[model samples]
Target: MNRNDTLVPQVFADGFDPARVDRSRYFLSLLDEGRAAGLFSEALFSLRMNELMERLAEQIGLWTNGRSSSVMQETAEALLNNLLYLLDLALSAAPEPRAAAAMLARTPVFPLYEAGMLAARRHLDRCRVYELALKKFEAMVLLPPGPAHFLHGGLRLWLDERDLRFNACEELYVPSSVFGRSRRLRGVAEAEAALAELCERLRSNAAGPV
Candidate 1:
């Protein structure tokens, strides 16, 4: 589904003039806004994915028949964009999160997306994808609250950046004690409290020693 040999740094919308807008960047921005607001719908994801796939297919066919630089570049960028979006959709639709420990034991596709992102190495896309990926897991863990939830590597890095500084492997046994691999987080209130405590510890960590 990804073809990096032909990716460009920017892609415009299906109909928008590239001279006027970078559609790939624009679409990604919208995805960011949607994810942040916890406002995703299967309908929207389906519609957008369909539209992008069609355009990508056309570009691939064109390039296949006639080696067009323009076509190849568009296809490459769009492919990575699609994966990023698809992962977002999956995270949003997780009406169920696996056992918290199960998640920590192995991230589902976080690593895959992170690797594909190397192919998506255009500066702008790079800036956005990791954060988006982490945000997806963040949103997933913060769901109405249920079993003990765990943060995978990407999500853990995200929390750390936001001043939470959890050890992806250890959480310094701090968050591990609070949000460890058990069904400890019985509800949202507890989860929120734990996150608050993590933030406080991060502040202290920042202020003390080294």
Candidate 2:
């Protein structure tokens, strides 16, 4: 089945046995083989797998009553176990082990700095997407949340910057004042700067002892 077609089953709402859903097992198998063959980057693959696991958790949560049956609990546990296993594998495959070790020998500050840089860059990208979406909040609200929350939140922050009291629940009725006026452009600029700084930090840190 296409990944996109993996719908949350109605049985989940009635609290069906999670063990009955075998597709996760199949996906895990595919991931394992992909990793073994080096057909995918471990970090990227782990991130994607984690996303899938999170979606699964969300579906299960929505479907099952808080008091899950034994099979449901077991399935949840299995999913958690699988996520952690993949995480461990991804961390073990980090590309800068030698550099990290050498940096550790030089200064405790280096590793922290390096990690900070990487995190900043990731946040910057996140913020940029957010800012863009914020600028087009009306257009954004029409799109589904799946991958768009990343952008949606950024736009919300922009509204916040403008002293605009926007609620996502209000949905798509953005006044021209909010979208057309130049008053809120500063938020976008600031977001851009923040993102740029994050990218610079990442580049600098990666070029460090690591």
Candidate 3:
């Protein structure tokens, strides 16, 4: 039901006015404040998203060109997943995250959906870049969590400049701001470069005092 060109940046919000606000920082800040206020419930967020979808059914139908109900539903479901991913990123970035979450009732779902779509696409390309580099390191192993984790750590740092150094973590971190870059990046050249850098690091690790 969708064209290849229709696959726009998954991070671009449908109605966000970038001239008035920084898309990445704006959602990030609201997410921070909402979490501090004891919001961020997944169930509630899903429920709210459902309600938002119901309201947008007509618009969705128009976009889908009167496709079958099932196709439209599938489209809505995909969009919902994208929205949830966006919220997950925001909450993950907050300090002292609570054990529970509440719905972001005041949060605008439409813009969130748009942002989610954009994020999902950018994340895929970034992942593609990393996966390509990973193939070269399959035989290499390192201490504890192993080489894969270390390689991921490097990519995460490269993706987000706010970070000063590589910090290994269990969760995969995708920076919201990376999708905001003006330059378009496909994974090929980046993967080649990353592989070269990783090979250099491996050699350094294997080297002994002269």
Candidate 4:
């Protein structure tokens, strides 16, 4: 596919805020490096994209007097899925900057394109760990005061369901839960560590190649 010449090659190019430019460049650079290493996934991308979409939805929701807009939600989901496919394809190719032009020409860069890299690169077949961690997350939520704590990039209990308050952060989900007394992770470090261990576990199928 021919690269779009009109593309900005970067996300934040307002040219007014130096800090924004620098920060965006840093993230874009991380994406380039991370993509080269094959450490990116559609799930991670969706997580970040949804966060942005949620915020946008909130503002637009206010304009519409708190009315729920399923259309906007659906549109965001579709866009994220398409973007995920494009990033997966572009990163797979791993092309270099062949030539520079007088003007800055770049493709659209998303915020978590770098974060999607820094976070868990893939969703493994060993979902057992996520299953267990989710149980932990559930137990925490069931506690008195209704637990609210950090898990990875975001927080928990965004959506409530029958017997289980779920949607902890973006990348997590809890469909249902069971009553069980178990040792739950207490600290942020502990929770993050356990999540990392589970999400990073390599599946036998995904081990061979990118």
The best candidate in terms of lDDT = 3
RMSD of 3: 15.3
TM-score per candidate, chains pooled = 0.22, 0.22, 0.33, 0.22
Stretches of candidate 1 above 4 Å error? 1-24, 38-40, 66-210
lDDT per residue as tens, model 3, 79-121: 4433344544433333422211222333355544454444444
Backbone clash pairs for candidate 1 read 11-23, 12-23, 13-23, 160-165
Backbone clash pairs for candidate 4 read 7-106, 8-106, 9-106, 9-107
At residue 173, give the lDDT of candidate 4: 33
| Best model number under TM-score | 3
lDDT of each: 0.36, 0.37, 0.41, 0.33
Find the 10 residues in a row with the least total lDDT in model 4. Answer: 160-169
Which stretches of candidate 2 lie above 4 Å from their native place?
1-25, 65-72, 75-210
Each candidate's clash count: 4, 3, 10, 4
Answer with 1 or 2, whichever has the higher lDDT.
2
Model 1: per-residue lDDT, tens digit, 6-116?
221132223322243222233444443433333323344444456545545543554456455355465566444555443333332323222211221122344433433
lDDT of 2: 0.37
Candidate 2 residue lDDT tens string, 1-210: 543223212121222222332332333443454344443345535555556555446434533543553345766665454333322222322344332222222222223333433443443456556455443543634433422453345445544443111111111222233223222222222445443443454345446784
Clash count for candidate 2 is 3
lDDT of 3 at 2: 39
| Regions of candidate 3 where Cα sits further than 4 Å from its true position | 1-51, 55-65, 70-83, 90-93, 96-105, 135-210
Window of ten residues with lowest summed lDDT in model 1: 163-172
